[model samples]
Target: MKLQQRLIRLSVGVLLLGLILHVALLLGYEQLTYRDRALQDLRGRAQILALNSAAALAFNDTRAATENLQTLRTAPAVVLGCLYAEEATLLAHYSPSGARCPKRPQPAQGAGSIRHVESVMVQDQSVGQLLLEERLPTLAERLPRYGLLLLSVIAAEAVLILVLVVALRRRVLIPVHDLAELAARVTERRDYSQRVSTHGSDEIAALGMAVNRMLCAIEEREAAIKENAHLLQALIDHAPAAITMKTMDGRYLLANQQFAEQLGVSTEAVIGLQDIDLFPTPIAQARDQADRAAAQAEGSLRVEEQLGERVWLSERFPLRNAASEIYAVSAIATDITEQRATQASLAQALANLTQLNETLEARVAQRTFELKQAMDQLVQSEKLAALGSLVAGIAHELNTPVGMVVTTSSTMSERARELKAMVEGGSISRSKLTEFLEDLGAGMSLIENNSLRAGRLINDFKQVAVDQTSMRRRQFDLGALIDDTLHALVPLFKHSGQRIESSIGPQIACDSYPGAIEQIVTNLIQNALLHGLAGRKDGLIELGAHVSHGTVQLTLRDDGKGIETQYLPHIFDPFFTTQLGAGGSGLGLYICHNLARGILGGKIEASNHPLGGATFVLTFPAVAPQRASDAS
Candidate 1:
C-alpha cells in the first residue's frame, strides 16, 4: 500500500486496539460487578428468610418454615432454598416446581452460582439456618448487550481516526511527497534551481531543505568536473608513454602526441581512424583484436604486438559507466624492443626466449639454454601423449572382459529366477535342474575369469603408466617390462593393422630406468608405423633382447621401408625429420637419444636393417651407470 493508506490504517488500527483493550477491561470489571451483585442479592434474601424461618424452627414447625421459604419464588435467580434447624437438622427444603434440590447443600458453590447460608436469630439466640443459591449470567447471555455498546463506541472512534489521518496527510505526508518529487525532477534535469517549499520546522520540511542544499552542492561539483576534464586532457598530452583509446569496433576516440609520433600521423588525423588505416595489415588485425578483447574484458589486459619495426607492449583497460557497461577501451603502450635487449623482463613475463638485449656471446648462451628447455618440454609432451595412447588402449582392452562379466551376470540372474520359478511350481525336473546348475557354474567361471583378466590388465598398465609419467628410477624385471610394453602395444598394432612380437623371456633383468626403455620402444614402434608400415597391413615388428657380460642389448626391427642413406646419420639429431610437416614432430628420435644417454647412461644407434626395414638397437648396463645428477 502507499504511505497515505498505511498512515491512515495505522491511525485507525491504534484507535481500534485501544477500544478493544478498554472494552476487555470494562467487561472483566462488569463480570466481577455482576457476580458481586448476585452475591449481595443472595445475602440480603438469605438474611430476611432466616429471620422469618427462625419462628418455625424455634416452634418446631417445619410447615411454617416451608411457607416462609416460598417467598424466594419471586426471585427467579434462586435455584435452591433450604432451611436447617439449630441442631443441624433439616427443617424444610424448597426449589422450583420441576427443579430438584439436594438434601445436603454445599456452603460454597463457586462461580456458576452464589450460595449463602445464614443462621436464624430469635432475640440474639440462634434457632436455624437458611441456604439460598442464585445463578450468575453466562458469557452468552452477557455478550449481546455488551457487544452492541462496543460497536457504537468503535464507530465513533473510526470517524475520529479518519479525520486525524486526513489532517496528517496534508501536513506531514504532503511535504514528504513533494520533497521526493522535487528530488526526482532535479536528478532528471540536473538542475539546481528546482526546490520544494520548506515552510515549517518539522522533519519533512527539514528533509526538503536538505534536498535543496544538495542541489546547490551538485551545481558546485559541475564546475569542478569541467575543470578536471581540462586537467585530464593536459595529462594525456604530456604523458610519458603513448596513450590511445578506441571503440570496440576499432574507431579511434583519442590519441596522444607519442601515439601519433609512432603512427607517423598528426593527432587530428589519428582520431576517427581505425587500426587498419594506421598500421600494416597483420599488425592492425592483431591490435584490433586486442582492442575488442579489452572492451569485453572484466579488467586490464596485456597485449604485445609489433608496430612498424619495433615491438610494443600495451596495457589495455575498459572505460565503464555507472552501470558497469563498457563504452570504450584505452591503452598505454611502451616500445619494448629496446627494453627486451637490456633486461630479462620479457623472459620473466612470458617464460619465453630472451636474447634481444644480450651481448653476442650471452645471446648465444641464452638461446641455447632456452632451446634446451623447449626441447625438454616437447619431449615430455610426446612422452605423455604416448602414455595417454597406451592408457586408451588398455582401457579398450579392459572394457571387453568387464562388458562380458556384466552381460554374463545379467544372464545368470535371469536363469536363476527361471530355475527358482520351476522349483517353486513343483515343475522342476532332473534334466532341467542339472542344466541350470551347469549353466550357473559356467557363468561363475566366465565372470571369475574375465574379472581376473581386467584386474591383470589394470595392474600391468598401472606399472607402465606410473613409471612413464613419474620418471622415477627403480629396479624392474627387464623381461616383465618388455612383456607389458609389448602387450600395451597390441592395441597400436590392431589400430594400425600390423603385428608386434617379442622373443625375450623373464630370465633377463635390468636395474636401469625401464621408463626410458619403454619410451624408446614406443617411439620405435610408432616410427615404424609412420614410415615402414604407413599403408601396409602385413607389417611386422620383431623385438629381441639378450644379456652380454653386464650389458643388455635390445633390438627392435620392423618390416617396413628402411631409412634413406642420406638421412640415416641425422635421424637421431634434434628436430631431424625426413617427413617434415607430415604429422611428424621430428623430436621423437631426439628424445629417445637424450633419454638413452642422459637418463639411462647408455647410447642408442639407428640404422637400416640389412635384411629388411629399419632397426634400433639400445645398449645399456644390467645395472645402469650412475647418472650425473646422482653422482653430483
Candidate 2:
C-alpha cells in the first residue's frame, strides 16, 4: 500500500485504541461503584432491621423478631436473612426464595455479592444479630445497553474520519503521486535531468524541492559517469587483449573493438549479439559453459578456448553491481597459440629425458634382482645348515649314553671270565660268590639307564625329523613338541653357554602342522640366540607354550639386548637384518613369521621386553584352518 493509505489507517487505528481504553475504564469504574452501592444499601436495610428488633430480642419475643424480618419482602435480592440471639441462637428467619440460611457461614467480602451483618443493641448491650444478603447486578445484564451507546458514538466519529481521509488524500497523496510519476519518467528514459514541480510550502511541496535538487546533482554525476564510460570503452578498444561484457543470458552488453575484430564484426554490430550468433554451435556452447561457471564462482576462472585455428587463454569473472550481486560476466582473452607450441616442444624434450632415466632405472633394478637371488640362495643354504645342526646335536647326545653302555658290557664280560676261572678250580667261596653277584647287579643297573637314555633320544629325533621333512598336518601335544624341538636345538645353546628356561604347560594338544610350529619356534629361538643375546654368552632364552579355549600361545623371550629401535619394525621382513653377514641371513624371523601366520593360522608379534631383551609372542588356533590347495 501507499504511504497515504498507511497514514490514514494509522490515524483510524489510534482512534479505535483510545476508544477501547475509554470503554474499559468506564466498565471498570461502573463495576466498582455498583459493588459499593449494593453493599451500602444492603447494610442500611440490615441496620434498620437491627434497630427495630432490639425490643423483641430484649424481651425474647420470637414472634416480633419474625415480623421484623418479614419487612425484607420489598428487597427481593435479599435471598435469606436470619435473626440470632446473643448466644448465636436463632430467633427468626426470612427468605424471599424460601431458602434456608446457613447456621454458620464465614463472613465473605467480594464484588460477586453483598452480605451485611448488623448488631441489635438494647440499652447499650448486645441483644441480637441481623444478617442480610443481596446479589448485585452482573456485567452481562448491562453490557447490551453500553454496547448500543458505543455504536452510536463510533458511527458519528467514523463519518468524521472518512471526511478527513478524503481531504488528506487530496492534499498529500495527489502531490506524492505526481512526484512518483515524474521519477518513473526519469528512470524509464535514463535521464536524471527530469524534476518534479513544487506548488505549496507544505512537507510534500518541500519534498518536491529536495527531489529537484537531488536530480540536478544526479544529472551532473551522470555526465561525469558517461565521460568515464566513454574513456573506458576507448581504452578497451585499443587494448591488446580482446575484452567483452556479457549478461547472464549470454547477450553481449559491451564488446571492445578487439573482441569485435575476432568475431568478424564491427563493435556497434557486436553489441546485443551473443556467442551463439557469431561462433559455431560447438564453440558457442563451450563459451557459454565457461561463462556460466565464472558467474556462479566466487572468483575469476581461467579457461582455454579454440577460435578459428587460434587458441586463446581467457580470464572470465563476474561483474557485480553496488549491492554485490552478479549482473554479468566479463572476460579478457589473449591468443596463446605460439606459446602453447613452445610448451609442447619442451614437453617432448622432458619425455625423452624420462625415457633415458627409465633405462637407467631398469639397469639398477636388474642389479638389485641379482643381489636378491643371492640372498634367496643363502636362505636355502641356511635351511640345510639348520637341519645339519639338528643331526649333529642328536649324534653328540647319543654318543655319551652309547659309550657308557659299551664300556659296562666289556667290564662285565671280564668279571664273568674271572668268576668262571675260580669256579673251574673248585676254590669259589661264599664271600667270592656274594661279591660276584653284587658286581653283576651294579653292571646291569648301569646298562639299563644308558639304554633308556639312548631310546628317548632316538625317539624324539625321529619324530622331529619326520615332521620337519614331511610338513604334514597332525594332532599332537604342543608342550611335548616344543620340548622335542628344544632338545634338537640343544647343541645351538649348549656350546654357546646360553641358558634356556622351558615352561611347557600341561594338556596343550594341537591339530596343526607340527613342522611349521617347529620351524617357527626354531627360528625364534635361534634369532634370539644370535641377535637378542647381543654377544652375551650367558643370555637366557625363555620358551613357553600354553593352551586355552582351543587356542595356543607360545612366547619366546631372551635376556639379550632388545632389538635396535630403528630395526624393530623391519625385523620380520625378508632380507632385513642387523646381522646381514654374522650368522644372520636376514630370513630367520621372516621365515618364522610366515610359518606361524600362513601355515599355523596364528598371529605373531615382536617387541622389546620391559625388563631386558626381545620378546616374540605367537598365538594360534589349536585346530588349524583347512586351507585350499594350489590350482583348486
lDDT of 1 at 20: 62
Best by TM-score: 1
- The TM-score that candidate 1 achieves is 0.28
Backbone clashes in model 1: 2
Model 2 agreement with the true structure over 179-222: per-residue lDDT tens digits: 76875576457566677878867666766786676567556655
Runs in model 1 lying further than 4 Å from the true structure: 1-470, 628-632
Predicted structure with the largest lDDT when compared to the true one: 2
**Candidate 2 regions with alpha-carbon error over 4 angstroms:** 1-470, 629-632
Task: Please give, for residues 461-510, the per-residue lDDT of candidate 1 as tens digits.
Answer: 44443223224467888889988766544433544568888898888977
RMSD (Å) per prediction = 35.9, 38.5
Local error of candidate 1 at residue 122 (angstroms)? 99
TM-score of each: 0.28, 0.27
